[model samples]
Target: MAATLDQVRVPRARAGRPRTRPDRVLADKGYPSKANRAWLRTRGIAATIPERDDQIAHRVRRRRRT
Candidate 1:
């Protein structure tokens, strides 16, 4: 679930349009699978999701590029 403030309160505090964009977003690991990250990148959202442990290990072993 979204934070309570986001769901019911923050919308009313928007300074401009209802679709006002954010300067950045902070996210947890669960939100940044490959496809999700790619989609967010396509839209220019700066995602801060960290790689899962298994993903980190695999990347290290294979020298995969981000």
Candidate 2:
């Protein structure tokens, strides 16, 4: 995933350097890992990755307790 993301090159309209960081990433649940999400967050990239089933269940349980 890191290798794939590093290869991204979005050209500028006027003229300049290509964008290394994309505006957003739409990935599957399988791609939503703590490391992956943190990487995108630090780069200020928006991600549309769904939480895994276990993660969702854990979140729900935690919420109910509070």
Of the candidates shown, which would achieve the greatest lDDT relative to the real structure?
A: 2
Per-residue lDDT, model 2, residue 33, is 91
Task: For residues 1-66, write the lDDT of model 2, one tens digit per residue.
Answer: 788999999788888999998999999999989999999999899999998999999889999984
The TM-scores, one per candidate, come to 0.61, 0.77
Number of clashes in model 1? 0
Each model's number of backbone clashes? 0, 0
> What shift in Å separates residue 41 of candidate 1 from its native position after superposition?
1.0
* Model 2 ranges off by over 4 Å: 64-66
TM-score of 1: 0.61
Give the number of the best model, judged by TM-score.
Answer: 2
Q: All models: lDDT? A: 0.60, 0.91
